[model samples]
Target chain A: MSSKTANPVMRSAAWRISLWATLAFACGTMVVFAFLHRFVASDIRQRTDAWLTGEVEVLGDVAEHTPKDALYDRVVSEVAELASNEVPNRLRSEGHSNDLVFFLQTDAQGALTLWVGAGRGEAYLDAIRRRPFKPDEPQDLPVAGSDAPYRVVALHIDDGSIIYLGLSEHDELRVLRNLRFRFFTWWLLLVMLGFVIVFYTTRRMLSHVREITEAASRIGHTELDKRVPVSARNDEVAHLARTLNHMLDRIENSVRQLHTMTDALAHDLRSPLTAIRGKLEMSLSAAAHGEQAEPIVAAIDELDRLTEFLNTSLDVAEGKADALRLSKSELDLEELLRGMADLYEPSMHEKNLRVRLTARGPVRMLADAALMHRMISNLFDNELKHLPAGCTVEFVLETAQEQAKLTVQDDGPGFSQEILPHLFERRVKGKQSSGHGLGLAFVDAVVRAHGGSVAASNRKDGGARLELVMPRGLAAENAEPRPVIIAIAGSGKP
Target chain B: MRLLLVEDELEIQTLLRNSLQEAGYEVDVAGDARHAEQLAMESAHDILIVDLGLPDRDGISLILSLREMGVSAPVLILSARRSVDDRVKGLEQGGDDYLTKPFAMAELLARLRNLLKRNTPATGEPTRLHVQDLELDLLRREATRSGQTLQLTPQEFVLLEYLCRNAGRVVTRSMILDKVWGMRIQPDTNVVDVHIYRLRGKVDGKGQPPLIRTLRGVGYVLKDR
Candidate 1:
């Protein structure tokens, strides 16, 4: 549910990979387009300049060979018109009479001798005169009346005059603009296509991995036999699924082995213990009123203690190994605590101790009822055994931050300083304590198995305090519900 | 009452049979599931005590088959597996009661008696229960002894009612916890002893013969002498 509600798109590896790849591709294509645009603009300018230089040279030669008369002017003008018409007309707009090129002749006195072009040649001649021009070289010059600069080439003739040929850069600029527009449109389309392709392919490839993760999450401890679905494609995801399944197989095997081992051990050990206790009881009943009866009863009590020790040891071992099996059910902690308090009230009274229970309403959680009962009983037993007379024991139960908190405090001699650090460890207890030292260890195991935490400390005011915090509604998520079957014959009250 | 016991261990089988016979019941013994089934089908019995570790087949499957064969007698399961899950499994498979192995003979007998009592239906509903001079008005939830009103809390009343129901029979602490307080696991404390002590003080006044008797290390019995 959390995975569904979180920002899944940004978190997904597929989306991140595709977005980065698209960015890289877009940048690469833009750089290439910029280089190509620069090359094309430069190439067009060079061709225009070459054409202007050749025309200017030929016109200068024609002026030098002709006599200084009206026929000479007519000959030069005709040659210039023919040359201007020879320029490329591929991108030229129709119904435009000007050839987009101009021809001019200037005498030594800096006066315009002849002009042949679309616009008035005075602007071009003035623009050329403003900056000293090198003969036989084409340079860009901006005239006063034109929006586009002209590429002009000048040549010196034998009659102390200069011939100028200027070609308008309007067509070159238009060609470059068209190239850029088309390139940008295509570039945008390609970039979008690249993004979609990368995103789609990456998502398709990673869907199997997501499926495996979902399936694996569904397999709880009880359902270890279930395995994730492996894709048929022999890819990395499939390999990962196979590895996980193999690990599960080993785990299930070891768990099965542990169960078998504990079961066999319990059977082998408890059978003999049962027989001995039975014999002792038979003898005790027969010698109902003699000293023999007392000894037999004591032996039976010792046997019972031995049995209790065995059960607790096995339980602690399993719990420490993280293999404790839990049968979960919904229970009210407040009710359970109250019941425990009532059960212990009489015993506490006999010891001249006072007890109080503080709780607010009900705090419900899912947990193993039997384990919870034993865990709480162990706590009470400890207090009953250790606390001095006239001491008070307090139990407080409440829910905080979606966790059930239970605190048990007593006004008695706290734990010995030496054993305080290792209190929860197995076989750790005070020097004067007469227990097998597994009571607190068992409690710690139960709490840890339930995914909770427990702490034991001495209050500064001379008492012991134990606190436990367990997450609510966690066991239900991990344990599958078992069908309940009530025996029909014993359903009624006796 | 006639009873059937199926156990694989020879020593336990002998000990239990001797104990049950001494308690004045005719018990039939079997060493395995096959023999137990044969004994059960041959004659009707009032109760069956089954050990879960059977040589031939699991005790759970045996119980299921017996139930299917129309053996409606209540079953008491004896087992070495002490986990709650195992206990629940045994009961779910049609066992009426469960006792873990290495148990006290008194506990086993108490369970047997309790199971037998469950199988027999009471004649009818009675609004009041009378034992000696003590009177319980079930309808009003009140108690009186020797014509004098007794003060009892609601929980104490329930506990007295349970004791009165099985007046002559011994009721163990675990039984009282289960029946009166609805607790399954027995806490290691003398809560039962203290409660019984208080109840005895109230039920038998200074001159009255003590009605509640304590069997040290076993349980309690209420007898009208």
Candidate 2:
């Protein structure tokens, strides 16, 4: 799991998608909470104002209708009850909260007469005293000892006294703070839920895509029968699986058809060739010392040459078509070259040719052993067939950087000027050659298939030179060097 | 020696029948797998030459049937399928040897003769082999001509052994390549000729009559006059 998250792209993609989605959802939730906050705050303010206005209206009506003695008696009792921390008799009848409200009234003499409130109310009364009260509009005034601001409503009563109704904003603010707290808690939960949802959906979708990629990587030439499993979901991923399977089917069919056709063609062409060669041999043996014997023998040789040409031609064609089935394995270059040399030693002797093999230790490479043998054999055959008597063929195997280089050089007339550049081309042969001119072409194909290159050129010292370089197939670079051993005197003797 | 030649092509059947019979073998020809199977069961032949592409059934299956029927004649597969896979499958399915089509007559004859030599029961057999003045010890891997030990390389020993086995018969270069180097066919090279030349030097010493003769364009033949 730690290794998986170490990839920056995978980590960032998941984080980015989840984070952006959570942020958008959180912003939308905040907008909704803000709207509810505004509505509740306004409703609380309106109820507080209505309660204060009702109290003031009752006091003004009592002042107008009742005798001075009765109204004064009621006002004195209300102030006494408010001062004693009890609800006022007149305000209590309407279920008003006078806990944080201040009621200040004056008599007709324009003197401060009634300032009745206590505790938090006393702070509100002092705030009213510091500022001149307006009768038409409500004013907000800060309490002297509290962070709450008061909503003060002042009125001119018929008793020639002004009345002020101040309601503290502390309760409303506390209610709003509590509502905001609850909203934030819910928003946090919402953001977390949004993140998990986005992460899960994205991961599940990408896992299906990963399955397709893995299946594709496993498909090769020999494993054409394997197909990506199609899902039951009628979505885009399943559709892609179906399309890939269809394409594989087409490829496998074409390959099978090609193989069958080539096999049939080869069998058909060789049957008559075999019969003809057989007839020629019988005729040559039965000729009984006549002119017919010479031509019959010649025809038999020609047939043998034709059969060889056909086999090499088919190999070249198959190599070009990418249809050659090679079983690749690790091979020792020195050992393989030695085997070829031993096999050809006798032939080289008959041509008066000297064969030399030079190698720097056992150079290893990955290749198809059979094809590589044929390639080397063809190279030797080319030299022996073309070079005159008394020539030397040198095979050198060594390493150049990470590549294993094999150079086949001969001390004979170099490739003719016209054919030097086209030495490896198909059907390019010397004038006196009996080959179908596909030898070097086969060598080139085999080398290229092994991720190597083959080149032919005329040596400046008057000979044809061919070089084949292939990548060394071992991880020798990372191997630790052998430690040097120092012989201690008499260590074993002691 | 009695040989069974199973081939579908009429011309190939006629040619092989004539050549094999002329080489002093009693040859029987079969045009298809059914006929070949019938012949294999009835005749106690020394060798069976079967072609891969037969009309009724493939040659590999026919060989398997023959083996199942307890007919122990050495079977040689002749096929135009030159792929290594076909060759391996042929050998694996009870075939003693495999020769692709359009082959040299000398190679076929040499291989057939060699197979017969292998199957022949020995009576009072010795580890040493002799051909006129030449002698070879099978165990020590040494050769001597007229009591003079001949220094020979491992390859020369194998080559000479093959030539000595098919003493008076023509063994083609392809046959030598197949037997000595274990190669199927190598064209346009004098590797076999050169080896034969070197081996002749040591085998035919001073004042010794020439024993190995070149058939020229055909192959080599060893005999004692």
Candidate 3:
């Protein structure tokens, strides 16, 4: 509740998984549709080519055997029987939409002969003449203006006797057309079905990943006890769960280590500190009562040093002891800095160090005021401990043009740049450092909690400066912000 | 001075036992809840230090279960399960104090002594939570966080109590599912969130602090603040 972390703000694993899975499913659906379309079309072409070839062969045989007049006589006689037998009954009984037949040639007077006008009209002959064809010796003429195609063959008799045969390609063309329609319908349904499956599966998978990701993110933000749920079976999701849970184990261990270390420091150091305080109190009382003034004064100074160390040690223990105990609220940073200055002024005066505080308008921030209060106070302690004699300790709190800086500088002896990087490292007591070496460590921890960065260096004018830099709004508000939300995981899976 | 400690880890418990006795507190040690339960039933001790991950039973369950059979002693929970959810869970189950482990013996003693000092009268017959006109009668196991009262199923009341007790801390998705739902549904289901929303709508009516607010980047926090 206290920390403003963006760990859970990014796209969820579930959403990512679903997105990719759905995309893959759509691509596959397209490929299958294309393949199906081409397949049905190719099949129709091959069958039509074969039917046309068959019509030519059958007509060529009749021309080779039967004479022209006999062919005409045969056509005239065969209409009733062919109607009954040659076509499907639906076409036979229904005459207008039926396959038509006819023959045409030059008459004995050299005019065109219209001999065999059995079932067809001139439209049939006109259709025969108009269709495009190659001059193969057994080429068939194409039929026109029907749901299915028809082919015609013209045979020249020996005495210039023109004989012809007409065969309807209605059935084969119908089959091909029907096949294409059916294939389209079936394939369309298949593709839709595939998409639905992909959507559901992807959504489900992504949602699973989302849950794990959320859990992992929670663990990253110091919820060390949180663990990713591992399914009893061993799969990738389960593997991820197991791995995260393993990491959580270490985190919990380290968290426990931190607490134990704090407790140990507090308990271990308390007795020695109490003994020193007791002796100093006794010495001070004895000095007031008797004439041993110098020894009492020396004892009092040593007691001050011991108490200071004890206080710092207790602070280290508290930092680790209840780091999880955070009381968060929305408060302005400007006011908080003022409060810190007021609390630390007496200590600064005791050391004869002038402390300066500055602020403009309100700078709103969400944090645990008590913790932040302690954090800045620790920084002031460090400043007082390391400042040069007669040098004022300046506490500068300023925000200009969107960037906020909090700097604590001392007039005391400053360290070289080499010791700068290690100042914030835990337990690293530098030459000009204060309070058992954890003052900067505690400051670093608090800065990190605010999602800010800390740097310690010598001032351009020969002093020690600890600067904490953060965006005017918590790094979160200043960031290219997005709502911490996502489409639930695995929503896209089939 | 003598304390019966129930913990699974030999190393941690041994360190704790040695540390407690060194700090001048007598300790009766049990590696798991079963042994501790037997020892606790038979003997007398000043206080108890319990670990949740016991071999026989969850330390919380053991404590609550013992309370059912009338074991009236202050219990101090020392666990590695250090979520606010876990802490709230231990307290809800009749634990007097909850301390996440890697704790100093002195702090644990301070907490134990504090519990020893503040002796609350046990609710012998009628154990219930009453806030304002609302009464959650544990004996009858009924409902009421505010004026709108209803008879709840046992499961529902258990869930509500956990949420109500941890009213100001962020409760994780796993916490609700693990403790309340208890591995019934697949972890992937939004049942926890769904049920929480349903419960919230029912409990926090008209206008209120939304008893449960999602913490955006974290879990759900039960805070009116």
Q: Give the winner by TM-score.
A: 1
Ten-residue segment with the worst summed lDDT in candidate 2 chain B?
B86-95
DockQ of each: 0.59, 0.50, 0.02
User: Which structure among the candidates has the greatest lDDT?
Assistant: 1
DockQ: the better of candidates 1 and 3: 1
> TM-score of predicted model 1?
0.84
Candidate 2: pairs in clash: A347-B190, A347-B191
Poorly placed runs, candidate 1 (over 4 Å): A1-6, A45-49, A52-176, A289-292, A349-360, A386-421, A455-467, A474-494, B83-95, B189-191, B197-208
lDDT of 3: 0.57
Give all candidates' CA lDDT scores: 0.81, 0.75, 0.57
10 residues in a row with least lDDT, candidate 2 chain A: A485-494
Candidate 3 residue runs with Cα over 4 Å from true position? A1-51, A64-177, A215-243, A288-332, A343-370, A381-416, A427-437, A449-494, B1-225
Model 3 per-residue lDDT at B197: 61
Residue A120, model 3: lDDT of: 47
C-alpha lDDT of residue A22 in model 1: 91
Quality of candidate 2 docking, DockQ: 0.50
